[model samples]
Target: MDEHESGAAASGASGRLARYVVAATLVRSADGGAVVAIVLLAHASGQPDWASGLLGASITAPHLLGPFIARRLDTARDGRKIIAASALIHGTFLGVAGLMLPVTWAVVPALLLILSGMFGPMLTGGVSSRLPSIVGRSQKSQRRAQSWDVASYGISGTLGPAAVAWIAATSSPLVATLALATAAIAGAGAVLALPRQSPLHDPGTVPSPAHTLGSIWRFGPLRRTLGLTVIVAFSVAVLPIYAVAVAPSLGDAALAGTLVAGYGVGSLTGSAVLMAWPLRGDSDKLTSVLAAVVAAALLLVIATPNFTTALLAFGAAGIANSLFFAATLAARSEYAPLETRGQVFIWVGALKIAAGSAGTAVAGTLISGASWLPVAIVAALSAAAATVCLIQRSKGRT
Candidate 1:
C-alpha cells in the first residue's frame, strides 16, 4: 500500500482500538465502584474502620506494582497481548470475587488486590500504546487525542459511581459486583478483538521500559506536569473526606453520597469542555494555574455552609481537575517517546495513586480532630506549593 493508504488503514485500526480502550476503561471503573460498595457493605456489617480502610488500600495498592510490570512488558509488539491477558485475568478474578462474596473481609481485599494488579497495567498500557497510532506524527493531533482520552475517563468515572449507587440502593452489593464482573468480561472480549498490529514501533530501535521512563522523567515539561498531577490527585483525595465533613450540614449521610455524585457530574462536564477546547499553550504553565484554581475551589467547598454553594464550589474543583488532567496528559505524551509511553504513563499513574492515598488518609485524620476548614487550608497550601514548584520547573526548562 502507498504511504497515504497505509496511514489511513492504521488510523482506522487505531480509532477502533481507542473505542475499545475507552470501553475497557469504563468497565474498569464499574469494577472499581463495585469494590467501593463492597467495602462500604463490609463496614456496615460491623467491620472495623481500619479493616475497611485496609480493603480500600487493597483496591489501590496494586497501583504500586502496575508500573513495575508495565516497565517489563510494555513493548510495541507484546504490549497488546499483555493487555489482553490482563483483561482476561481481571475478568476471572472479578468473577471469582463475585462468587466468593460475603465470605470474609480479608478474602474480598485479597481478590481486589489481585484484580487491580492485573487490570491497572492493562488499562494504562492499552491507552498509552494507542497514542502514536491515533495521533501519528502531528503534535497538535496528539494533544487533542490526549484530551479525548481524559474526556472518556471523566465520562466513565461519572457513570461508574452512578451505577454503584443505583445497584446498591435497589438491589444488593453482590448484584452490583456481578454487574461489574459482566462489564469486565465484556471489556476483555473487546480487547481480544483489537487489531494486532501497532504503528508506534520502529523496527530498528526498541527502547527499554526503564529508559523510556527515565526519558519522560528527565523531560523538563513532563517533570513539571507530574508535579502538578500530584497536586490534582491530592486535591481529589480530599474530596470524599470533604463530602463526609459537610454531610451534617447537608442534613444526612445520603447527601454525602449525592455530593460525591455531583462532583463526578461536574467532572464529566468539565471534561466535555476541555474536549471542545483542548489545551494548546505551555502545558506546564496551564497545569500550575489549574492547580491554583483547584486549591481555591476546594477551600470554597469547605467554607460553604449550604448544599447549593458547596455543589457549585465542588463543581469548580471538578473543572480544575479536568483542565489539569488534559494538560498533564498532553504534556506527558509530547515529552515521552512512543516506545516507552506505557511505562511513562504507568509511572505517572503510580505517583497519582500514592499522592491520593496520602492525601485521603491525612485529610480524614485532620477532619476528625480539627475543623474542615483547616483541612481545606492545608490542601490548598499543598496545591499552591505544587503549583509554585511546577512554575519554577517550567521556568528552568525554558
Candidate 2:
C-alpha cells in the first residue's frame, strides 16, 4: 500500500478502537457495579443477607455457560449485534431488579436477572475477542489496541464500585442501580458504532468442546497465561476481604475502605503505564516476573511495621496484578488459534469468574481466623502460580 493508504488504514483502526474501548469500559462498569449494588440494595432493603447473595450469584452463575454462548457468536454473521444485545439485556433487567427488590417481586428478580447474564460474555471477553479484527491484526496495531483494551478493564473495575458506593451513599442503592443501568444502555449504543465483522475464524476447524478445554494445555503460552489469570483471580477475590480484615490492626477499622480504594488506584496506575508504553520483550517472562512482584508485595503487606507501609504494599500488589493481566490479554490475542478463538476467550472469562467465586468463599472462611492468614494465603498462591508458570516455560523451551 502507498503511504497515504497506509495512513488512512491506521486512522480508521484508531477510530474503531477508540469506540470499542469506551463501550467495553462502560459495559463492564455496569456489570461489576451491578454485582456490588445488588448486595448493598438487599442489605438496605432488609431482606435476608442470602437474598442479596442469591442476586449476585444469579448474575455470575450464568457465565459458566460462556463456551456454548460463544460458539453461537462465532457462527453469527455479526458478533457486534450480540454484544449490543447483551448490554441492552443487562441494563433492562438490572433496572427492573432495582425496582423489584424493595417491592413484592421477591425471588422473581433473580430469575429475571439470570436471563440477562446468559449473554454475559458479549459484555466482556466477547467484546475483546473482536479487537484483532476491529483494530487490524498487525503486531503494532494489535499490541497498542490490546494495551488500551486491558486498561479499560482497570478503568471499569475502579469506576464501577466507586460509582455505586458514592451514589448509594449520597442517594440510595436503588438510585445507584438505576444509574448503572443507564451506563449499560449508553455502552450498548457505543458498541453499535463498532464496525461489523464477520467471524474472522474458521468454524470448520473447531473441535468438540471437550477437546477445546484440553487445547489450552497444548498451547504453551495460552496455558501459562490463563493459569496465572486463575491464580490471580483467586488472590484478588480475597482482596477486599483481607483489606477489611487487616484494618483493625492498622488502628482504624475505617482503613478497610481506604485500602481497597488504594488498590484500585494502583491498578489504574499500572494499566496506564502499559498503555503509555506497550509491553515488549518475551511476554511469558514479563508475566512470571509480575506474578512474583504480586507475591512479594503481599508479603510486604503482611510484614509491614506501619499502616502507611501496609497501604503501599496494597498498592504495589494492585499494580502487579493489573500488569500481569495486560500480559495475559496480549497472550490470548497472540496465541489462541484462529478457529476457536471466540470460545476460548469466552471460556477463559467464565473460568475466571468461577475461580473468583470459589476464592471468595474460601477467603471468607479463612479471613476470620488471623488478620495475616488470608493475605498470607493469597501471597502463597501468587508464588505458587509463578513457580508453575516458570516450570511450564522451561518445558516449552524444550
Candidate 3:
C-alpha cells in the first residue's frame, strides 16, 4: 500500500479501536450495575435474601453453557450479527424485568432474566475473538488491544456496581434496572457498527460443544491458563474483606472502600504500562511471576498493621492481577487452535466466574470463623496452585 493508503488504514483502525472500547466499557458497566440492581430490586419488593441470591445466580449460571453457545457462534456466517442479535434480545429481557414490578410477576421476570444469560457469553466471547482481526498480527499492537480490553473490563467491573448504587439511591432501583436494558441496546448498536468479516471457524471443522470442552480439558497450556485465571479471580473476590480489615484503623470504615477502588485504579495503570511497552515474552513465565507477586502482596496485606501499608499492598496486588489476566489471554490467543478459539475463550470466562463465586463463598466463610488471616492463607494457596501450573507449562508438560 502507498503512504497515503497506509496512513488512512491506520487512522481507520484507530477509530474502530476507540469505538470498541466505548461499546465494551458501556456494556460491561451496565452488566455490573444491573447485577447489583437486580438484588436491590428484589429486596425492595419484600423478597427474602434467598430470592436475591437466586436472581444473581440466574445471570452467572448460564456461563456454564458458554462453550455450546460459542460453538454455535463459530458456525454462523457473521459472528458480529449473532452478537448483535444476542445483545438486542438480552436488552429486551432486561426491559421486561423493569416492567415486572409490584412483585407479583417475580417468577416470570426471573425466568426471563435467566434466559437472558444465554446471550452474554456470545456477546463477550465474540468481541474477544475479533481482537486479532482488529489489531492484525503485530505483537505490540495485539498486546495494546488486549490491554485495552482487559483494562476496560476491570474498570467496568468496579464502576458498574457503583453506578447502580448511585442510580438506585438518587432515583429508584426500578429505574436502574431499566437503565441496564437501555445500555444493552446501546452495546448492540456498537456491535452492529463493526465492518463485516467472515466466520472465525471452518464449517467442516467445527466440533460439538462437548468435544470442544474435552479438547480444552486436555490441552496443557490452556488448562494452566484457566487455572491461573481462577487464582486471579479468587484474589479479586476477597477484596471487600481486605478492605474491612484495613478501614477501621484509618478512623473510618468508609475508607476501606478506597482499598477496593485502589485495585481498580491499579489495573488501569497496569494496562497503560502494557500499552506503552508491550511484553514480548512467554505468557507462562509472566503468569508465574505475577502469581507469586500477588501471593506475596496478599501476605503483606495480612501482616501490615497500618491502613496505609495495606492499601498500598492491595493496589500492588491489583496491578499484578491485571498483568496476570493479560498474560492468560495472550497464552490462549497464541496457542488455541483457530477452530477452538471461541470455545476456549468461552470456557475461560465461565471458569473465572465460577472461581469468583467460589472465592466469595470461601472468603466469607473463612473470614467469619477466623478473620482475614485464614482468608489470606486460602488466597496464598490458590496462588501457589497457579504457580505450579505455570511451572508445568514452562516445562513443556502442558
Best by lDDT: 2
Error of 1 at 386 (Å): 4.7
The residue-by-residue lDDT of candidate 2 on 42-96, one tens digit each, is: 8898878777789888888887876776766666677778788888988999899
Question: Per-residue lDDT tens digits of candidate 3, residues 190-289?
Answer: 9777766567545779888788777876878777777777777777788777577557766788988888887777887888877777767877677777
Number of clashing pairs, model 2? Answer: 0
Residues 179-297, model 1: lDDT tens digits: 76667667766666655546344633546556656666677677777767776787678888878877876878678877877777778777778657777787667777777777777
lDDT of 3: 0.75
lDDT of each: 0.67, 0.82, 0.75
Ranking according to lDDT, highest score first: 2, 3, 1
Off by over 4 Å in 3: none
| RMSD values, in order shown | 3.9, 2.1, 2.0
